[model samples]
Target chain A: MSTSTTLEAPKSGTWDGGNEPMKASYGKLMMWFFLLSDAFTFGAFLIVYGLTRHAHTPYTGEAEAFTFSTEWWPIPEKVFNAFPGFHGVDLPLAFVALMTMILIFSSVTMVLAVEAGHRMDKKDVEKWLLWTILFGATFLACQAWEWTHFIVGTDEGMLLPDGTTYHGASMAFNQYGPPLFANLFFFITGFHGFHVFIGWTLLIVAFISTVNGVYHKRGHYEMVEKIGLYWHFVDLVWVFVFTFFYLI
Target chain B: MAHHIENDFQQTAEIPKPQTKAIWRTFFILVGLTALEFLFAFTMDAGTARNAIFIILTIFKAFYIVAEFMHLKHEAKSLIWSIIIPLALVVWLMVALLAEGSYYYESITNYFK
Candidate 1:
């Protein structure tokens, strides 16, 4: 398929006259563009998050001692205090921090895969890609646990403006605080989770292709590098989300 | 036959060596930053100062990820500028919206309550 392009003499120049004006492969450059656009999408979400959050009355409750109310925004640590296997213990930011570590580690593995691809070390590529996929799934699973806790909130439900107590959070109501909080939480994290799912699926495909020696036959592992760009972008988005959503 | 084969095959560039050491170094830096952020989140009181610190640290982490993890730092200068220049607009959007949002908050507190 690519033979015709290679038939011509290999042209060379940094900026004066090369086919790759940016010194990057066409696929890689296109992937960078795609990621840049994706960054804007996430940026908009997080900015809107900041705007809406600022619009709400700031939470002024003492640290770790908070109650749900509609009068102001709920403290993030108080809201996301649940941890697996630690029932009734308020471990604020711990689980989310663990999730952050998982994602960062996974990004490490992904870059390793890309590095392996550079060396055309197919076995290492397969190994690191598998590790990346595993970590991605683990992050998703952590998110699922978090969502479950969010949806099935604390037993001591808060009183709504209507003088009725409501438990848990849905699109219509939130036991934590304002409705916008739940909305942004579901939307921002949901959007990010979907990206992780898609990236995970792409990693699976890349892993399978590596196992089948597809890139081996093609004489280049550019596909792994492209997907690596995507996977790293996902991790990059999570760092901001970790700060704006959970931490700040 | 050899010359014909050489002409038929594409001239593949030399593959670059893997920088595992740099990768590990970046990973450690990211982890340390995250730990520091966690510390600040808990120790510091909720205020503009804490929030500003968080934003600055987040930006630092972002720079490392983009430059090292995504390999944007090693890319051609033209490519580097192409990506970073557009993101400045996002910063503009943020400042504008934040100012607007605070205005909304003030109006709500003054009138709605």
Candidate 2:
């Protein structure tokens, strides 16, 4: 390696998101590139979560001395454990686990849809697309329910001396952790939920086009493969969110 | 012109039929990893070691998704690095931000608590 290197711009044979030297289409490559940038944004938000969580450690000297204080961070299991149709039941991480399964299953359906597209089978593509949309919708519904319960927090929050309570989840506070906890939760989960909705709508369009025999006339399912890339990328981000936000 | 365009489309070679079994295998691996994460979560208390394990498993799932589901593993090396290198930078960003943020957290707690 030399410290001083001459710089030159190549006049030919360059790949700049448009070139096909990678054997992938421009749209597919761009989608990957865009996801890469999106990953950084989500990563930054999670890092902020880590930062705030670290700041709010509990008093850990002795049992008698340690009393409930406003600064201590809330435990994960204690914060999120309510399941749908289970009134006041304690199911730690069970419902979120179900949400994870739904999301992962949707990813599988998406890949199958892409596979059908590869085989130029419009009927199978439409079938798989429908399944993917259903799974995505189900995941969204679960998230909505989780959010509702989160805001309605089953935990009866203590009254602050300042005449307000840290109930459920809000910008001001939550019974969970510090004030920042609720903010980070809403930002990260809300962003990921928005992405799922986007993918779901795109999939709807792909399904409709497949039903109209559009790929049949075109003799290819490039559209399906392209959308598959996006869908898979969304699933990949959720893996991180699941780990950092929910499980960990 | 329409006939010419259709003829041009045919000239481009297409890959073999869909690989459904391969995807099923990927799905099983993802499910297995998730199950392992849950097992760890339930068995172990929240500590540095558990956090490390969670991060590693999460990254493994991320790799599987990118390489297998996104098909980047089969793509050209240059293309793979073009995306991978930037993603690595994001990891670096995490380290940097977390370090500074931890410092701030320490200072605040020391003063207030």
Candidate 3:
């Protein structure tokens, strides 16, 4: 009885040997830690990108139009100057802005779904989850289009060191700035896009489970909460990627 | 067997009341910050000052997403600190590696010259 009371004495404290140490459930706590580690993974990628970029000299030419040069780092706005359905028009950062809005809106929808789940409103949860999924898929489609445009070169191809003109970007060649530019672009954004794909799939799973009355029967919607953490983390990473890779 | 399964499905914790107002407010804040980023992208010159501004804005956006959208703010203090404190290491990594990168750049330029 004395030992039991001793254990109970610390019941309200964080390390009280309670099931919830940090006032979060076991699954939610695990999810938070997972995201923390995931943040490190993304942090490493962006840092490596920054490190490589620091190695290059900045472009200092006075060119009005986009030109492929291996002498210095290409101006980002010059390289990414195409908007969908606007052929031959020089619109920089517009498409990525649209992409950002799509992602942010999707994140809002995801949080709304979590909010609905808190109230045990299954119909509302399902509706918002569907919206989030739609937005996610739309964002993925935009990424696909962006990648295709990047791979299909602009009118003026870059002159390679070997006396050949390279039009598109690959693992070994990039018309934009340097080969490392394309490599990092593919690595960082590809990894991020894969995260979006996984988040989308998870949303679908959550949606299906909601439709099947899983959360309704289970008496709580912590599943939605856990997945919401992941979805928001993806959005958060993109904010940095947009700033570091595109804006600056 | 049925009773045991039913017991497993019990609610784990109390669900807080819905904060629809705050959610919409956060949405608008995010949109406003993004608009500001776009404005700066065009209006500001490309240099260290502009990059600093972008980094600050990005951090603000990240805060909103993690604190509000992910509901980290409402979580326990210990949990919040546990996540934020460790992320300081990332800042250290950035400082150390970016310095190394610049050193490499200097090495190449100095050697060739």
Candidate 4:
């Protein structure tokens, strides 16, 4: 049996790019287009990040001369090591791991929601959508806490040779290493957080429509499926961000 | 509750609850990958090898997300290539930019000395 019912040609008709290209609706194709371009933007951001890291080492000049290294990039392990409510304990990546898990779980919830859509189960779709929204919101709350900790800074600031002190991440002063690290962190994570907020809002819209019987009347849940695509794309982006910024 | 109990052929065919075994399997795989990633962060020191391992795992997770969760794997071959083909350029962009950036860095360090 063929994988797609729609893609199977009529008994013997000439093939043409019909209303649905390769069995995908216009909206689905458009969403894929938007996601593809968005991926390019993220690629550019990460490439720039790698570029900066290549240019700037921990020390300024050669080791023999030493000569006051201007580019003092901090090791990521040092800056992002604390867990919420566990003061004085260094949990390097536990919080981020939790956040990653939460987001991955949300993606799973979204897949279940889409699967429910395929079965035309409005109630189950709504239930799973709500769960996804809850997971997404939890991830956002964790990010807010991480940002707050970074700003308020439990760790003491580092001292430069000139008697100046570098405090926790601001655009100007970076306690971690160079100010650039802080700037990238703010830009990358802040940008990603904004996407999460938008995704949550979209989930609410989908949930409302599901509750209102919009899809039930239409006898299909393609809208839920479309939103699922967007939601999963967000999780995919976070996977890359987590690998590059946090791990490496 | 109105149309739910009807014995209409189409309605009966569209079961209200589909088996979710695949979904549960997917969840476990993704979570397991993440658990392994977390373990790596703790056990392994940062370096090229560690970074390579992270990237490989990330690619695995990405494949699972796109193929399984997004259901693109179920779609037609043409549609899959339409998206993947353009993304290959992003890889070229990274290599080009980073190589030039590193070259400039080598010059800058030499000049500073």
Candidate 5:
């Protein structure tokens, strides 16, 4: 019923800095607490988006008028293209879907690495951590490609009847949907892509540390556990993004 | 003392026994579930039905991820509830906002016409 009840402190434990009253280690517990607050922040953004979508006035001009149809979020398929080689091909956010899978699969590898660390298998930890890093990097690379595709118009710019060139990432919407949708799309997903970049950097650091015998010397791989928390958090955020932005 | 230290090092060097087949079985089940999600996404049209299915499948995926991968299922009941209850708040907030927003939107559209 109360916030305190929801956030009830973990059990008291010997490692919990005597008098701290929490059973979990300071670092691990802090990660959970941080994720909890971050979750609320994202929740607010999504709720506002829902509110805005409800307020949107359907564009009901001529068939050629700039607007969205009920079919899909107006021309999401037209706006998002894969790369240079695929000119005029309608892939419809295929690249973003791939990026989502990469992140989710990396989360799998991260958990495996954490499990290895728990069992004190340094070599297994290193292997899986490396795999996690590779997946993260792949995700980052795909995002970069997506960004470039967004900024650059397809082979020839999409020409409207009025002859105004419609860049894929334009501030104007075509028959597909609202212009604000594109603006919000770039802003929100770009911000998330930045987080993915940071996550990749952190995983690289953990990977290097494992290779250099840092955790082996420390007698425990709590560092790996901490990074695993971060990696999984990124994946969790993507779950929301995939649902709200793409599927919903 | 030196002999005892050597014995401890030897024990540490020995690899721990692998987990039973149950772990791999669970992992394969997760893979199958993921494949199912993909199949639904590709085959289904975007509508209320597709959205409902996506939501259900995503929740299932998340449950497995949290329970098995994150080890929450094995944790204390209190700990598990601590994570679940807050997340439930988030989902509730999303649903409420969407419903209210859609209602207001409909009212405004009707007023303009």
Candidate 6:
């Protein structure tokens, strides 16, 4: 009957602001702090990426004479040139664009769901929450398609005239871009995608709980607010990804 | 159990209301900037100009996301500064390391030549 059960006292009692708990709800507040720390970790990754990119030889001039070929680190456009059903059409960076839109739209739906929860509009909450889940699923589907497009070349997975497949990573080079670019791309986005998967699972659980009248019985929707924070955090990280990885 | 409607109602009253139209306006601005980034990437010859355009647009989008979606603009000045200052530091560190690394790379390549 009460949501108070979800709150617990910290061992140190440091969070005890007099009678109030040091934090808010145990689960929700902890998620916020966790996201803040996670933000720092991603910051470190981006900083390292910038450093490595700076160290790489630029794609021009006398430097080309010293290397095996003047091709330089494959430009991001040259590397990620994939789209559905346009064989060799050179639709550079199309897939990443779609991924970006998917992430941003999902963030929109998440905020809407959170808004509905605040209004205590149960039907709106259910609808918007379902929409949020659908958007998340769509984003994941797009990511999978992007990976497939990356791995198997544009059509029938044919090799280029250079005798290498259209998509594959090598120590010397990558089909989509420089080897480091592809490597970091997979690592960073893959980790973020994993977080989305986790967020989706939490959202689904919350949706089911709402259907079962859990929040109705408890008289509050703080759980939805907490999950919304996590969802928004994911969108926030993608903003940086779009900037540093895609744009720059 | 006593029903503390007074406190509960007061808390509810203090919860800031969503400015729907303002949020929509900010969202459109973000989408517009993203379009500009894509256009620059596609149209411009790859060079310093393209890179500058991308970085500028990215900063614009970041500003909107933080100010609008995260509601940092509505928060206390201390809270705003707390988040912004650290973010600025991170960006500075990234740029500094990148510039220094580039210089070192140029020197090493020239020596080898």
* Best prediction by lDDT: 1
Off by over 4 Å in 5: A1-23, A57-72, A75-84, A155-161, A170-176, B1-12, B17-31
RMSD of each: 6.5, 6.5, 4.2, 6.8, 7.6, 8.4
lDDT of 4: 0.83
List where candidate 3 sits over 4 angstroms from the true fold.
A1-13, A63-66, A161-164, B1-18
Show pairs that collide, candidate 2.
none
| Candidate achieving higher lDDT, 4 or 6 | 4
DockQ agreement of candidate 3 with the native complex: 0.56
Residue pairs with clashing backbones, model 1: none
Model 5 lDDT per residue over A96-194, tens place = 667766877788788888878877787888898999989988887887777677666565555566766655565565333555676767766776777
**Decreasing lDDT order of the candidates:** 1, 3, 4, 2, 6, 5
Maximum-TM-score candidate: 3
Compose the digit string of candidate 4's lDDT tens values, residues A1-248. 87766666545432554445478888888888888998998888888888888877654343233222235655666678889899979677788888998999899889999888888877789999999999999999999999998987655566678987655667887667777888899988888898889989999999999898777777788888888888899899999999889888
Query: How do all models score by TM-score?
Result: 0.90, 0.87, 0.91, 0.88, 0.79, 0.78
DockQ of each: 0.50, 0.57, 0.56, 0.63, 0.41, 0.30
lDDT of each: 0.89, 0.81, 0.89, 0.83, 0.69, 0.70
Q: For model 4, report DockQ.
A: 0.63
Model 1 over residues A55-163: C-alpha lDDT tens digits? 9998776765777998889888888888999988878899999999999999999999989887777778999999999999999999999999899888788976678
Better of 2 and 5 by TM-score: 2
lDDT of 6: 0.70
Where does candidate 4 stray beyond 4 Å?
A1-19, A58-70, B1-14
Query: Model 3 over residues B23-104: C-alpha lDDT tens digits?
Result: 9999999999999988998887778998898999899999999999999999999999999999999999999999999999
Model 1 chain A poorest 10 in a row by lDDT: A2-11
lDDT of 1: 0.89
Choose the strongest candidate by DockQ. 4
True contacts kept of 4: 0.79
**What would the per-residue lDDT of candidate 2 be over residues A1-248, giving only the tens digit for each residue?**
78998988755656444457878877788887888788888878888787776666754554234323456765666667788889787688899899989988999998888887777766678888999999999999999998888887765564677976656767886766667777888899999999999999999998989888777678888888888988898888889888988876
TM-scores for chain B, in order?
0.80, 0.81, 0.82, 0.84, 0.76, 0.75
lDDT per residue for candidate 6 within B14-39, as digits (tens), equals 44554467756777887788888888
- By summed lDDT, the worst window of 10 consecutive residues in model 2 chain A runs over A60-69
Candidate 3 or 2, higher lDDT: 3
